[model samples]
Target chain A: MDTEQQVMDHFEATCRSHGLKLTHQRLEIYRALLQSAEHPSAESLHKQLETRLPTLSLDTVYRTLATFEQLGLVKRVETMSSQARFEAKIEQHHHFFCDQCRQLIDFTWHSFDSMGLPEALMGVGTIRGKNVVVHGVCNDCLEKKKKPE
Target chain B: MDTEQQVMDHFEATCRSHGLKLTHQRLEIYRALLQSAEHPSAESLHKQLETRLPTLSLDTVYRTLATFEQLGLVKRVETMSSQARFEAKIEQHHHFFCDQCRQLIDFTWHSFDSMGLPEALMGVGTIRGKNVVVHGVCNDCLEKKKKPE
Candidate 1:
């Protein structure tokens, strides 16, 4: 099986193992993350989710997203911006923040597993264990600059 | 000169170079950061600074601390907690976060700079490069486990 399928299987098994009910809310949130390319804030996700699940509480989205983040199905990217952004890529990778648009793009095909931070670093709370951030303008932003005659 | 003195001198120089007026508020905030071992949240720093500069505004403390963080005179450590934490150790190093105490400690000896990330990882918007975090329990927590009554 391919990686995405494997990841889906893992999430399903994880939910079962944790005895977490795979409710409509959970499935909708997971599907939303799976479908989304933009690193969206919880508020953004809530707004998108409202169209399908009109009765969904913003608090429920936040709580469920937090749970998914803790479950390793999503990533929370830290920006200087007030709203927190999240991505669904589970594999090891880094991100680039568009300075102009403030969008985040996944810089894939990288792993920090061999980065060799000291053993003591592992002693803190559950470390996601690695961090990598790249910030700059995306190609779309660059293309926009070329648009003016 | 000792490290703290050297750091203080550097802080002052950095301020002068940046054309920032080195106010008592800034200096006191820097002093608190320099003297602190525990990575302090802005609230904690404000409380400490309030003792010395009785009329200092919490907003001023927050703003000044943010300015220092931006100038690289101090660093911010990401936490699961709501508030961001600051550390005085400006060198390229990892951190040890205590899950129970919500404490952040400096672990200065990691040499991950030589661990080359792949070229594909260097995409646009890669600003200021990368930082690595290896989270886990610290030695103190491990020791705390073995305590006998």
Candidate 2:
């Protein structure tokens, strides 16, 4: 994973190569995505940036994130929810999503990393990346359920 | 995996158990999802069902799918794309998504199926399901890229 500054620099270089202007909104949106560990959606990002960027609209945030996605500078985290979540960490990792708490936690699986693609997927595609999302009730939620009201 | 008829019967049972009316629209939407392997979005489903149900609206499709999701009658296939995709097959399986062609293929990994949850996730949550999505350029797209147009 790149350092925060390195990620920002790469973002700028990628924008230059794509002939896209490094607008304030775009930079802020990318920064917000980079800084957040929660894999926030556009609406959440817009809300976070509202005080700092009072004039920033949610539509602009959505469009900027879409452009970043097109440039391969960011990734959209897969979720069962209707809203799309964005992340700037383009690293090899998996997610553990708590269905009860709605928390998305990232964890790396070395065994999976070492294991090659499954035999079943041999001819399916030119494999780029694999992501696993494990959905369950988090420990805290389970504890809460255990305790009687 | 349940047979198509079995899946539909289960849907009816679930709706009835939840006290949701087994309305024509809901039944048709669930039927379309059951029949489709594409994991279509609400918009695509609405377009597919429009010919059969002239009065059905996209909003209804979206709402019905949401209700079905809340009721655990359908599973939303996670995708990087903004549009949410729905699938009625709740069995243990995985997906291979082609970024270029936008094709979502389902494949079962017995090894993954047999292997218990990774050691890292032991305390993170009470695991219910693990879904793997592999993203890549499909074979056809790679062939197209190789051939000079």
Candidate 3:
């Protein structure tokens, strides 16, 4: 994965090289995604972009995200939520999902990137990539539980 | 995870002890999950159970799977796919997802279950549970691509 600047540069170059049209909505969506520290679902992105793109439909946000995925501009994350989420395709990183808040926090660990596939898997299948998802309540959620309303 | 017989024994015993209602719908769904060698989406599971459960609705299939998950009888896998898929809670194992065919194959690498959370993750918060998902092209998919249709 790359940083925000790198991702932006790649996004622009890819769009330009491919001759893909960068409509206002698509550009804003990409910018919003790059700025978000957490992977944002389409609905959440739409919420974030409401003031800028007042007329944007949820459907258009969904379609644009899919197009971004096909163009290799973003990655779709399957984080067990009802809504689909998108993350800027940076380098290899893992996610800690705060189930209570439905938030995904990213962290990098070099060991995981170099973990040779165990002998059993390598023998049967070709290994392309892997991700370790540590799923549980985050401190924020746990602390919230402790506090009384 | 446990063996098939053990899982069956636990399932039956748990249902009996908790007085969990096992309607025909629930039992058939459990059997479908247990017998399946692959994680299946609701649509796929419904298709499998259609003949055996002529009156079964897709909604019913979805609801029953959720109930089973809550009861700790099944695990919902959040792989990077559009549809929600599930696994029968048998033992500790990881999934190998084939990008080409959108298929999930299970493999066991015991070390992962005991993998120490790297130090980076330790300082931030509590560690609960983690799953390792290896994504790549499966042998079958590669073989299919090689041959003519």
DockQ of each: 0.41, 0.70, 0.70
Q: How much lDDT does each candidate structure score? A: 0.74, 0.87, 0.83
User: What tens digits encode model 1's per-residue C-alpha lDDT throughout A56-119?
Assistant: 8889889988899888778777664667777777767666667689887676533555545566
Native interface contacts kept by each candidate, as a fraction: 0.48, 0.90, 0.73
Best by TM-score: 3
Q: List model 1 lDDT by residue over B66-85, tens digit each.
A: 89888988876756565777
Per-model TM-score (chain A alone): 0.80, 0.90, 0.89
Question: Which 10-residue span in candidate 3 chain A carries the lowest summed lDDT?
Answer: A116-125
**What TM-score results for chain B in every one of the models?**
0.83, 0.89, 0.90
Q: In model 3, which runs have C-alpha deviations exceeding 4 angstroms?
A: A1-7, B1-4
How far off is residue A114 in model 1, in Å? Answer: 3.3
- Candidate 2 lDDT over B24-100, as tens digits, reads 99999989888898999899999999999999999999899989889987877887676778898777789999989
TM-score of candidate 1 relative to the true fold? 0.80
- What are the runs in model 1 whose C-alpha is more than 4 Å off? A1-13, A78-82, A97-102, A108-112, A118-128, A135-149, B109-111
